[model samples]
Target: MRFIIDVLLTGLAIFLAALILPDSAVSIAGFGWAILAGLIIGFVNATIGTVLRFFTFPLNLLTLGLISFIITVLMVQLTSYFMGSKFDVANFWWAAVFAIIVALIELLLNSIFGSKDRD
Candidate 1:
């Protein structure tokens, strides 16, 4: 299904991002851990992340969407937390960088293989 493909793509992106970053910035146990991390990240984002974004909508608008980026950074940290020893981020700034890298990779992957109907 499309959802499965998306998750795999995100997992690949996360693994690639971790490899691209310095060892002190981000670490992953393996591709399997990266995939599990991606699933947890997606779940967290779909649930708690959505609520946070909704409540912070006003602040996000005022900040010209910077708040959204911050929220995304926090989501990356939260994902690391949920992943425990398998996936780790050194600090807030590093997590932000990791998030950016993962997002860019995901963007590139999705553009190449995403459903054609998506607008």
Candidate 2:
């Protein structure tokens, strides 16, 4: 189904991001762990991320949307925490870098393979 495809694509993006970064920056156990990490990332982003964004909307406006990016980086850190050693991010800057990489890769993959309805 579409949801499964999205999850797989996200997983691929996460795995690719890990491979693209230095070992100390970001690392995942393997593709399988990446998939689970992707799922957790989605959940966290959907639940806690949403609330945080809503509350920080004022800061987001004042910062010209910079706060949104910070929220995303935090989401990555939270995902790493949930994934334990399976998915590791070294520090705030590294998490920010990892988030950017994952977003870029996910955008590319979704544009190529995502369902037509999404477009």
Candidate 3:
């Protein structure tokens, strides 16, 4: 299904981001944990993330949509909190950066592989 594929892609993106970011930015026990955390992250993004974006529409407009990075940081931090030691993000800025990278990678992958949801 599309959801499962998204989870796997998210996991791969997170794993790749961990490699690019410094240890101080984000840390994971291993690939297994990263994949597990990725599923959680994806779920949070689908549920809470959607609501947050809707409610924060004003901020998004005021900030010219840059507030999205903050939303991503919150989502990533929430994933870290839920997963405990499996995932760790020491800095919110790092979470922001990680979120950006993950989003870009996922976007590229989705485009290259073809997405049914896209027109």
- Candidate 1 overall lDDT versus native: 0.89
Candidate 1's residue-wise lDDT over 1-119, tens digit each?
Answer: 77778878889999999999998889999998999999988888889889999999999999999988888888889999888889999999999889899989998998899752564
lDDT of each: 0.89, 0.90, 0.83
RMSD values for the candidates in order, in angstroms, are 1.7, 1.5, 2.2
Model 1, residue 38: distance off in Å is 0.9
- TM-score quality measure for candidate 1: 0.92
Q: Model 2 residue 10 lDDT?
A: 88
List runs of model 3 lying over 4 Å from the truth. 116-119
Candidate 1 clashing pairs, residues 3+ apart or interchain: none
Score residue 101 of candidate 3 by CA lDDT: 88
The better candidate by lDDT, 1 or 3, is: 1
Clashing pairs in 2: none
Task: Summarize candidate 2's per-residue lDDT along 1-119 as a digit string, tens digits.
Answer: 78888889989999999999999889999999999999988888889989999999999999998998998889889999888899999999999999899889988997899653773
Highest-lDDT candidate: 2
Q: Residue by residue across 1-119, what tens digits does model 3's lDDT show? A: 77777767778878888888898778888877878988888788889988999999999999998876688689999999888877998878888888888888878888887784853
